[model samples]
Target: MVFYGVSNFITLFLLFLLPLHSALPPTTTVQINSNSILVALLDSHYTELAELVEKALLLQKLEEAVGNHNITIFAPRNQALERDLDPEFKRFLLEPRNLRSLQTLLMSHILPSRIASHHWPPTHLHHHTLSNHRLHLTTNPTGAKTVDSAEILKPDDVIRPDGVIHGIQRLIIPRSVQEDFNRRRNLRDISAILPEGAPEVDPRTNRLKKPAPVPAGAPPVLPIYDALAPGPSLAPAPAPGPGGPRHHFNGERQVKDFIQTLLHYGGYNEMADILVNLTSLATEMGRLVSEGYVLTVLAPNDEAMAKLTTDQLSEPGAPEQIIYYHIIPEYQTEESMYNAVRRFGKISYDTLRLPHKVVAQESDGSVKFGHGDSSAYLFDPDIYTDGRISVQGIDGVLLPPEEENEDESSTPIRRVKTPLVKVASKPRRGKLLQLACSMVGSFGRVCS
Candidate 1:
């Protein structure tokens, strides 16, 4: 019995020693090179974020830094980047001249230590980012956590020996960059780009004066009123006079004038700024207008534009798409729209930007576009109606068909039906008498 017990003990000791000898080399190697695992995760799951890091030339710095410190990255998702970033700001960061600013912006998302979501405190905590900027963290009563203005969408996405990654919903713009953007947007002089040499103006109409002596073999000058006349008018409007004041109708100048007029007198400065600075659509529109192409634009008021969220406007090419959706290829006036409704009961026009159509119908003597719950009306129609361009003021912004469908699907529908009831009592003498009684009662209540 003693011999057998000793033999079993020897076998157990050898088994333990064998595992120790085999596992020592690999375990130490994995611990030393574990930082690459986080890099791999970024390349695989967070490609967009990875690309931004590479563009800023931050991958080398990250590699060197990861070896020494425990890092935490507030990485934005691809969809979030596509949908929430301001296009102008994104372009600014990608510019070669702004490499330092771009690096600072990227480094601002990294913290020196691992900070998991569960480690977040109830009260606000100020943490310094790698760029030496202060990042504020707050947790609301409802358990929503935010880092600066950006919300943390997914936390603890990757946990490695060297670091962790938390997905955020928006790009965290550094305060300095944001201030710079604001200053540039507000202070930039746009008048410097206006066309030189003012054309002679007609005192009565405030329009450019026509030059005398029409050239032979040139197209006749058609009256602006003729194009505004009612009927099936599908042909392009007559081209503006060459070498006359009409030549001053430079597309860039007209666009500038249109935007400036709205900003100065129409209380649409916010919308105007958005068009000028945010998207290239303003230039495109100006080019088309300069080429003497007739166009109609349904301009949304500032109040209507204020209702749009960052997510709604941040998608790639979203601003241009929205602006294009508002423009109609054909020049349309209020009179023409009314006449069309009278003749055909409705009118359809193609938009300049998308493969979408804007359908108009007369409702209570006013023109409304789109259908059902997606309809928008011209609250201030015929704001500007020259021969070449017509501007109508709309009450709401129009969404594309796909967006409308998504909106409808997400909204809850509550249908309530009114039930009919039969009464045994005799009816009143007449409908006019009942109306008179109700009006008298309403007046009495008002007086009281």
Candidate 2:
């Protein structure tokens, strides 16, 4: 008994420490002259950015003392604070809600050593933030160097012997991360990185893949209209049968009902477009109905839905889209999700409502949907109906898998969140919508 107890304790200790230890990352050591940089940061009255820098510095307990460590610091200037408290900027990078996540992000700004000039990790390349995120960086080596996809308005302000500095046009942040931006981004344009084209990209090459041709006998029109176009009035999805759109909902009528149960129980009224947007499922549904493939639908509850804005909720296509994005056309459950727990393990599936993905958390047995608003989980499984779709309710909203940009091919670093809804459907509520994005963390579930 004593031997067994000791062994179990050791194993438990190792398990507890493993993640924090493994996440320990590379640190940059640059020799510099400005010893006062540390002092300036530690001062309680220093600027917010300076305070953030100080907090970061204190946590690391650096031997460099700002100048001692040869370094480059991308420091924001006085003019940048004109809108510090604004909701957009404040809300940017707000999730992960802790210092470790923040540290990871702040560290992404540092490279292995003091890079004297504008050179690599890749010019126009995006790097992973310490927060385990990817931020867009653009370098105009010819015109002037820039990072974080922002213009360096005043480049290379040396902090004398301590480090180098650059004044950027906007606050630099990780992509799909808007915690800070919401606090200060009243001036930002909504279309900065709205890449043109469909979200599907080839997994192997990281390029956009052509939508597969509709199956040989499939319907002529895309289901974007048929599956999603509202009926004259609301009606329960038809039973699993020859009638209705053969590519049954959520991969089955049961999945649809499962969602209705979630909404009904959570006090919501309808579903989103997760169902109609999955081209592949639409294709498969046309061919096999429910007899093929296991499917799982991660559902969003009313509380999560409540965060969306009236404009987002009232947008003409909003309701349809919410349903489509939330429902997967196939069936997958907690067991499968837990099995596939690493980067390559996640599998994307099509849905009557939206594109869906299932990712696993290896340590915890619980399986949550892959994105924002999807933190919720099923109360129980085995939802059955005349409709064939089987579903389990989750607390948060479901998000589509992150598809890569064709031009960027196979880059390991990618944005955590991708916006799915166009602004036309979302009302401009300033920061509330962006701030609320923490719950969804991107993946277009920031509906309001």
Candidate 3:
């Protein structure tokens, strides 16, 4: 009897232990490679730096340098690119004719040898960059470090066997390049007064002939407003015009024109569709725009919207809620955003959706939104702004923090029902228990 009892106990133990072993997920192994550091940066939310490396085609060069020599990179956070750099300068670098300048600017951020924070000396030191430009580094008595004029905000952001990254507070522009850039920009500004293809002046009246009137059905022309112009402040919506539709204004046509422009020209077809078909938001947005109410839209690009699962979008009222989250009920032009960042370091504003707020942070020069692990940058800022309506392009969809928390906490509880079995004897009861245990073990293993 003692032997039988011991055997039963052992059998039960083996049954539980075997299932657990089989149910555990297999461990996954990731192979580190040349691009591993870059991947790490991306995983750590350093997307802006990753993009610059890819755009300048410096990844291979950085990788090769890592293999042969110690490499250090002065990476500018996304905010730097967005809000810090001069708009004209950024445009100039992107121009096809300025590829060499673009490469040079990118290379100037890299040092041939690794220089960790501890290695930095109190006195000014000279380091050679890949661009062949000599960068002057200095550490002050207060322990503030700078490369050229750019302050080192974060040191040893990433230190690995291959390379290291230091986050800078500003972009480094070499003196020679800066001088040339300024000269070119000045000439360009001067030339704007007399455009190359502009029509000859009518000296008789000192004014050109009026252009032909636009067709009745033609879209309204979108006026380009200066980004530096004062942004709109919160105010009561205007009452409807006499005998006009309740929500309609004389500016409604312009609002429609803008939406159409976004659809056909701005490459926001998916967003446009959501506005037009998914909800009555397009009409509502138009009304808001026409009423001169200030609004800023965190417009997600088509690719970002494409990442959503069918279920996420198909649920009732989900699409509208998501759209509401994207629209900030304030006029936030690029200049305003930059000023906000400079003044407060960060800004938080209520979205169209009640109680949900979007957080904005200015880093380096760019602006990033949301917070913690769930955040995205304004990949394309100042897409379209006219004091009353501002549309900025974002790279990802943002979920409200409360919604995310609720989702994490509310897991579905599943219950299994077993068929009732009538046992006639002790042997039958024992057999049923064994069968039930085996079925449960199998099911548990499968679920796990």
Candidate 4:
């Protein structure tokens, strides 16, 4: 009898919980349709926003919300995210621990209900975001629509039966996100509990003792000439070590690019061939560039190069001597050269060839290089200029003063005309040729 009474009491207790269990609502999963607004948003031109939404992992939650009511999304332009967004803030949002903050920031741009441009109120009105943040919608006096601080660049940019998207000029940042970013970025405040003191001051200078930070875009303190390798006359300089010094520019690539540009720019093929094919000057130039040296090449056109005789190129190292006279150690463009010549009557530029300087002057409203019979005019202003390597095209080849004088005086007829200036019975070859031959002979190869 006691067991039957206890069993009846247990049955009555179970019967009491049945109504409570039946009163609760059933749970159902909402399936996203192929033609849904969510799909449209993902496939739309607003790819940046879609990527953020997916990264925030709000798709499932948003799908459930969409199943219940329509939503309005304010999308920023792609450039705003790619270029205008602060790198630090973007990094903060992408951090694993800041996932909630990212979701909140993205959700703040969305409204729970459809609010198209036409549906927007004429006066200022506040709407609740999916994140439960308030967004102020208003129209300016000029009749342009705005949400929060961003102006609507395109109204009703993407419209679906269930939702609408408006294109905005920039991102709409929330106060919470701003505060979170500030709280995270401002390290001084977080470490304020630790004792702090004033910066150390120097007794002699009466200024902060710490070394001054280098300013952006300041030129390097070291001069280009100091970086050049020293060697015997006409001998190849050894390559610079990797860890020797800090390089401010990629000199080797710049030199190669300038040479290639000369080849492609037309009318400079001869100059390019002599530097790259006929000699190892191209490699030497690359090394010079790699060591932080800048070079300005006064390239002669093919027509001018064709004027050279067999004797000019036949001697050992003659090609190098001719080319060296054309290469100025300083970086100069057409504009700088023209301006310098215009300011000063004439300017003499130092070349790689030792003790030789090329003179420039303004003539016929253009910069003219060299002088007298062998002078060349700056035909092409700037063929290539990349901070380190500059190439300018000229109409004629430039010969050194000594070479010009020797050519004029070496002639028998000229010597007969002026018998006072005694000319040598046997002509002497260039010192450069002798040095080149000696260097080449060391390697058991004939230079000529």
Candidate 5:
């Protein structure tokens, strides 16, 4: 009887596990054909759209749709999705809970029937989408083809036997999707607000005191320079003496730590010396950090620093000006700088030197700073990054274009002689001589 009971228990457990095993996906996935329009869409220049489709888990659905009949897809150009799209709306669509809305949005871009650019109707025509939403087809006043409000930039961009893709200038969002996003955003905004007293400012620091704990990496409400106590010059104010209450971060310690890191980082001793022994700006920089201002230091290596002429450093506040030009009042890592250059081709950043900006561009797969002969490559990236302070080492010193132009203009030019072209007929010397002779003869003096 005991053996029979054990057998029964084992049988019941096996029965419970059987359904789960059956629910698992089959060993073989339905292979997508190389020539299918769906495959073309995935492999075409519409990479951003393809990524979103994949993220929305609509690949299988698209595949199924393509398998049934011919279809057309209106793809938004990468720029439209990357730069022109509303960031909050994009966020709303990408939320996991709003998966249905995302699916509807993507589906609204596709039509059941293949409609090429040439086949578009002259008059307004309404068609049903894969999401069963109505899309109005028409042309603009200039005769540029348009779907709803977005202009078709590239007509029949990618054509396969199964379907066609038209690139649009912007994403054509459905009204339903817009309403849904607005609703979600409103709710989020309401929930994010806290019932707190008026903001307080520290008299010494001149920074607004946070009522609650701020998230890591959050930008300060005020500009770094604004946080400085009233001062006559652009130079950083002397660090406050330790008497009042301290903030969450020990800005002084963080500054010291990074300076130590620069010393140990092998190629950056000159930069360390400038921050520590060479100047008192380091103390002020630490105060800025403690007041919730971040900084990115573009440190020139020892070799680069050695190239600086004595005249460049001999002037009053010259060293401070040079260092100020290198320090950006923001926290940026290697990945962020590289990404910015890669995306925008060129990016400009404001530096501590008021009104001067640093121009960065993508060069040989790295961030190149400054311009012309004075440019420097980001050689040692992210040498130090501790949420508030960031340091990047470079192979060459960076100088502003104005300063570079000034140096070039100041260089002594060697004098050279050339055969001069007669200008203004040499002031009519022959005529003048004739007049002189006539006047001298009349005056009873012999003409030479």
Candidate 6:
């Protein structure tokens, strides 16, 4: 016990006498003002990348971005590059096919806004990079670490400036995300054919003609918003302006305004900071509405929207159909609807000005607007908004019926056939004949 205590004390005394400079980073905080740091990085032992970027003029751009602009640089080390880069990517950058690849490679490291390692939110998130699209810093669900999915030969090349730059093991590009966007755009789906029109189908009977529909189950798909108000805030909502005022609106600005109004009316003005980051599909939305294209929007409530991801809303053409579904062709309200049991009959209606059918029904005591899955209860019958469209809330996601899988190559199901046999029995036959005769009420021919 005395020897062990002596060792610990000796270790502590040695640490106390050690030079502080060798024991820690110079400072936990740093300040940047001149070109000294960049020069020092160039002169540092990490010569391979520094040499390549020097030849490529990467340093020139870095100097420009960092000139008194406080940049954080993630500098990579020589051994780190050899240790971290993907073998295939390393080969591609060295190849001769791509010329503009170097610029892409360098720009991938820059971000428009300064983001220090400390400022990085400790949560899973998708962030836009300096290049406008590529380089999403995907933090895992645990949020303990982050990566760009591309090689960072050396991580955390600390620099005192606007932001940090790490020497990436290879160049970064936007091919994967770009390709995914294309694939989603091309994939086909079952769409409702309007009796009169839909881009995917003929205007005749409105039945599917080619590329037959799939079985989507028996649920009736209907529009979901009761009212188009932004959120349930008590703040005064934006009045639906006439077409002229709406036409000149900056799409992003309009959405922000709508969000603010919704928050105010919903009594959530305290969340104004969050409203500042709101997004809009307004320009596209306006185009669809102006062209008289039907739109229905499945807006996730604020609770739902907060958890929404890029996977949910990043598709380029998604806003079109989504907006179409939200719009009913003409205004519809419960008071204007025919609810009499005698008047219960199927009638075609318009959504975004396109023809659709509303199945009407009446029971022993109640009136049903639509049966089964297609049912929509008019929570607020005359809830009028903007005088352009009427609003009603619905409980579940409404969609067309699930159809049978009609792929031709599949085999038919087998069924067992019954055999036929006749037996002669005098006494039993007499009873069978009587039974048959009993089956015929009016005619006594069988008994005769």
| Candidate topping lDDT | 5
Give a tens-digit lDDT track for model 6, residues 1-448: 9999999999998888787747776743233345455665666666766665665566656666566454544444565456555444455455445324544554555665566556665554555544455445544565444445443444455454445555544334354322222222222111332112212223465332443332221111122221122432222323332222222223333233333333322323222333233323444334333322223222223432344356635665333333333345454455445453446455444333123334444444333444585454333233222222233433232332344567644777676998978987566547877877777854666567
- Candidate 6 has its poorest 10 consecutive residues by lDDT at 218-227
- Model 3 per-residue lDDT tens digits across residues 1-448: 9999999999999998998999999964444474555556556556766766677676666666656676788888788888876677788877777666777888888888889999987897889998888988898678899887678999998887766889988777654454445446544543554222212224576443333343221221221121111212223322231111222223354445446446423347788888888777777666555433456888888888888889988777788888888988677877788788778987888876656788888966788888775677878777665445678888888888865554444678576999999987655547888999999999999999
* Runs in model 3 lying further than 4 Å from the true structure: 1-251, 403-448
TM-score of each: 0.37, 0.32, 0.36, 0.41, 0.42, 0.30
Q: In order, what lDDT does every prediction score?
A: 0.69, 0.45, 0.68, 0.78, 0.81, 0.42
Model 5 segments beyond 4 Å from truth? 1-218, 228-244, 403-448
Please list the residue runs of candidate 2 whose C-alpha ends up more than 4 Å from where it truly belongs after superposition.
1-46, 55-60, 63-68, 76-97, 116-122, 125-136, 140-145, 172-350, 353-448
- Per-residue C-alpha lDDT of model 4 across residues 356-448, encoded as one tens digit per residue: 899999999998888889999999877776666788899999998874565455446633464577766875768799889888788776544
How far does residue 205 in candidate 1 sit from its true spot (Å)?
20
Put down candidate 5 lDDT per residue, 376-421, tens digits, no spaces.
9999988777677889999998988764554466579887999899
Rank candidates by lDDT, best first: 5, 4, 1, 3, 2, 6
RMSD, model 1, all Cα superposed? 27.2
How displaced is residue 399 in candidate 2, in Å? 19
In model 3, which range of ten residues has the least summed lDDT? 222-231
Query: How badly does each model clash, as a count of residue pairs?
Result: 0, 90, 8, 0, 0, 56
Show pairs that collide, candidate 5.
none
lDDT of 2: 0.45
Candidate 2 lDDT tens digits, 294-346: 33445554566666678755765565555556656444555445455543444
Best by TM-score: 5
> Cα-based RMSD of the predictions, in order?
27.2, 30.4, 36.4, 22.8, 23.4, 25.0
Candidate 1, residue 162: lDDT: 80
Model 2 poorest ten-residue lDDT run: 240-249
